[model samples]
Target: MKYTDTELEKTLNELGKATYAGEVDVVDKVMNRLKEAENKEKFSIQKERKVRWTIGTMSLAAASVALLLFIGNSSSSQAQNENDGMAKFISEIYNRQSQADVVYYTPDYIDILLGIEGMDENI
Candidate 1:
């Protein structure tokens, strides 16, 4: 499209006058809308940050609890193993005590009692 220079000047002059008179209510409405959108964006960003922090804290707490439980179970198993070892040691000691220095006698005791020639003193 082509316009004469005169027509362009006239259109520019009218636009200038309208702007100077503050007759551009659409611009003001657009500015207000932009400000509101910026405020809402800021609020949403802050809300997202808070939610992320809460989730992070909860995850850390859960991890700590899990670690504690793992430690407790490991310690309990170790203690049980020690108790089992002690019980085995005690049983071995009891068995040794019961078998100490007991003499057996058969009809062979009569030969030793009479001091026979083939009697062995080792018994």
Candidate 2:
């Protein structure tokens, strides 16, 4: 629905002259209600912020704990590797023995050598 400029001006003038015959305190009541709604909206926003902060704090703490656990596990594994000198020595000896056996020993001689070395004791 399109209106000419004159029709639009006349409609606006009529609307401007309209009157309300309702309660005298209606404006004040509506203003009070609007103020109350604004206050509730502000409170809800504050509550949401508090909840977000709490979740963020919890997430940070969990991440910290996970990092600490990972570091502790890595440190322990490193320490174990550092203390494995005997195991490394035994591995080297076994590798050398195998190479020597391939070049010099029969199966029977290798069994004798294993008995003499007390392989169980090394383990």
For candidate 2, write residues 1-123 as lDDT tens digits: 899999999999999999998857678889999999999999999999999999999999999999999999999999988779657865766777787756565544555654655554667
Which tens-of-lDDT digit does each residue in 19-121 have in candidate 1? 4645456888899999999999999999999999999999999999999999999999999999898788657555554665334423354344435536565
Q: After superposition, how far is residue 41 of candidate 1 from its true place, in Å?
A: 1.2
| Candidate 1 Cα misplacement greater than 4 A, ranges | 1-24, 99-123
Per candidate, the number of residue pairs that clash is 0, 0
Cα RMSD for candidates in order: 13.8, 9.3
Question: What C-alpha lDDT does candidate 2 achieve relative to the native structure?
Answer: 0.82
TM-score of 1: 0.56
Range of the 10 consecutive residues with the lowest summed lDDT in candidate 2: 105-114
Error of 2 at 55 (Å): 0.6
